[model samples]
Target: MFDDLISLCLTGSPPALPQDWWLRWSLAPATLLPLLGLLAWLLARRRRPLPLVGWALLALALASPLCRLAATLAAAHMVQLMLLLAGMGLLVLASPPRAHMPRPGPAAAVHGALLWLWHWPPLYAAVLGHAGLHVLALALLLGSAWWFWRAVLLAPPPWRGTALLALLATMAHTGLLGALLTFAGEPLYAAPGARAWGLEPLHDQQLAGLLMWVLGALGYLLAAVALALRWFAPGHPVRRATPAH
Candidate 1:
C-alpha cells in the first residue's frame, strides 16, 4: 500500500526529484547554521571575501553524466571519476569566490541557501546501473576525497575540521537508503549488470536510495560543520558584544 503511494508520487510524471535537498542546502544560514560563524570570523579580520569551497564541491557533484553514479559498476564510472578528480584539480587552482558579502537577516539567509543548492546531487538512481556508471561514482567520491582534502577542507579551517563528519553522513545516508530497498526485495532503480556484481535488482535500488541519504546528509553536514565551527569556536571574532546603556 505505501509502496503504491511512493511510486505514484515519484512517478506522477517522470518525477522531478523526491524532496529538494539542493534547495535547503543552498541557503547557508538556516541550513548551514555555522555559516555565520565563519563569515563573522572572516569579516571581523577585514579580509577580502574568503573563498567558499562549497561551490567547487557543488560543481564536481554536478559535472558527471550521472551527477552521482549510483549504478552497478561500469566504464562511465571511470570517466566520471576522472572528470571529478580533474574538476577538483581545477577547483584547487581556481578558488571559489565567497558569497556576495553578507547582508540583512532573513533575506540573506534565503540567498545563501540558494547559492548552496547549485551543488547538484546527480540523482544517479535513474540511469546509473549501466555497470559503467557504478564504478565511476564510487571512484570519484573516494578518489576526490583525497585530492579535495587539502584544497577544500584544509583551505577553510573551520570548514575543514567538520568536513569529514559531514562527508561520512552523506555517504551513509545514500548507502542506507539503497540498503533498505535491497532488504525489501524491491528495485526502485535497476542496473543491467547488478547480478554480476552480486546485487539483486531490488538490492541495487535499495543501495541507490541509501546513497542518496548518505551523500545528501554528508553534503548537508559538511556545510553544517563548517558553519558550526565558525559559530561556536571560542574567541571567534564574530562574537557580538553586549549592548551598553
Candidate 2:
C-alpha cells in the first residue's frame, strides 16, 4: 500500500507544458493583473517619477515565466519565494521615497508566521497540489513580506536599533528552519511528481533548504547593510526625498 502511494505520488507531475509555455506563464491570470496595476501606477505618477528598478522588479516578480515553470522543483519554488518576499517587497518600499514605515513588532510576527506556515511540509505539498491554493499562498507571502519590509525600511531614525535587532532575529529563526530541512535524513515532503525531474526527494528538499538559508538570508543581510548605512552614515537627517519631475 505504501509503495502504491509512492508510485501514485511520483506520477503526479505538472500538466504537460505547452509549446508557448513562456507566453502562458507570463500571461497567466496570476501574472497579468499585477503588471497592469504597475503600469497604471507608472502612468499616474509620470510627472514625479519613481525609480525604474522597483517597477522592473515588480514586473518580473508578478509576470515572469520562470516562476510557473520552476514550480516542479523545490529549488525553483524557493527562488520564486525569494523574488516575491524579498525582491518585490524591497523594491516596492524603495519606490515611494516618503511612505510611512509600519511598526516592526506586529509586522515581524505576522511575516514570520506566514513564512513558516507556508513552508510547513503538509501545507507546502497542498499548495503544489492545487493551483488556486498555490496562488493564494503566494499572495499571502507577498503581502506579509511587503508589510514586514515596509516596517523595517520606513522605521524612524530613533527606531533603527530595534529594526536591526528585529532583522537579526528574523534571519536567525528562518535560517534555523532551513538548517532543519537541510540536515533531515529523509524527505520531509512528497511534492508533486518531485521524482519526475530525476531528483531524489531528499536532495530536492536540501536544495530548497540551501536556497532559503543562503539566498533568503543574503537578502536580509543586504537590507541590514542598507539600514546600517542609513543609520550610521555621518550627519544628514534621512528625510524622504521628493520624487523628481
Candidate 3:
C-alpha cells in the first residue's frame, strides 16, 4: 500500500490507485510554497486582509496533490480544470489591486484560441510526460481563465454590454468544441495510461467533452446574468477602484 501511494504521488500515471491516494501527505513545493508566501504577505499588510474564501479556494486547488492522480481520467481532469478556474476567479475578484480588465471581445478570442491550442494532442502529451511542462500548462490555463472571467464578469459598467456578448460568444465556441469532442468517432489523443484506469478512450473523451459543453457553458451563462444584474440594478453605487495594499 505504501509503495503504491509513493508511485501514485510520483507520477500522473495510473494503476487504479486506492481512495487514500487523494489523502496522501505529499507536497508540490514548487506550486504550494509560493502561494503560501503570497497568503502570508497579504495577511501581514496593515490594510484589510485578502478574502479568506478566495485564498482557501486557491490553496485547495494548488496545494492538493490529488490533481495529479485525477488526471488519469479525462472526466476527473475536467473537474480539476473547473476547480482551478473557480479558485482563480475568486482570487482575482477578491484581490486588492484593481487592474483595468481587458476588452471582452479580444480577451474571449484569445482565451478560446489558447484552449484549443493547448488541448492539441502533442501539447497534452508534453504536459503529461514532463512535470515542468505540466506545471506550465496549468499556469497558462489558470492565467488565461482568470483573464477571461474577469473581462466577462467584472468589466466596468460602460463595457457591460460588450462583456455580455463576449461571454455568450465564449459559451457558443466552447460548447461547439465540446460537442465535437463528444461526437468524435475515436479518441482525440492517445494519452498514455488511460487504459490502466480502465477507461475507454472514446467514452472518456465524450465525458470530458460533455463536462466542458454543459458545465462550462452554464458557468458562462451564469456570469453573463450576474453581470447583467449588476449593470441594470436600480441606483447601484458606482464601483470604486480597489484600494492599494
Name the top lDDT candidate: 3
Task: Give the alpha carbon lDDT tens digit for every residue of 1-245 in model 2.
Answer: 11111111121444213343354235544456666776676666663333345566655544555454455567666776776665655455545535445677778889999989988888877776666676677678878877777777767665667778778878887898888888889988764435666678789889989988987787788888888987888995876632222
Candidate 2 contains a number of clashing pairs equal to: 0
Q: Residues 1-245, candidate 3: write the lDDT tens digits.
A: 22222233233455334455466433545655777786776576534433455566666655564555555666666666666676666666554425565777777888888888767877876676676777667678877877877776677666678889998988898899889889999887653445666678788788889998999899878977887887789998766643122
For model 3, the superposed segments whose C-alpha errors exceed 4 Å read 1-20, 23-25, 41-51, 96-100, 191-198, 240-245
- Backbone clash tally (model 3): 0
Tell me model 1's lDDT, rounded to 2 decimals: 0.37
lDDT of 1 by residue, 20-55 (tens): 212211232321333455345445555332233433
- Please report the candidate that would top TM-score against the real structure: 3
**TM-score of model number 1:** 0.33
Q: Model 3 scores what on Cα lDDT?
A: 0.67
- The per-candidate count of clashes, in order, stands at 40, 0, 0
Task: Estimate candidate 3's RMSD in Å.
Answer: 4.4
**Per-residue lDDT value at 66 in model 2:** 47
lDDT of each: 0.37, 0.65, 0.67
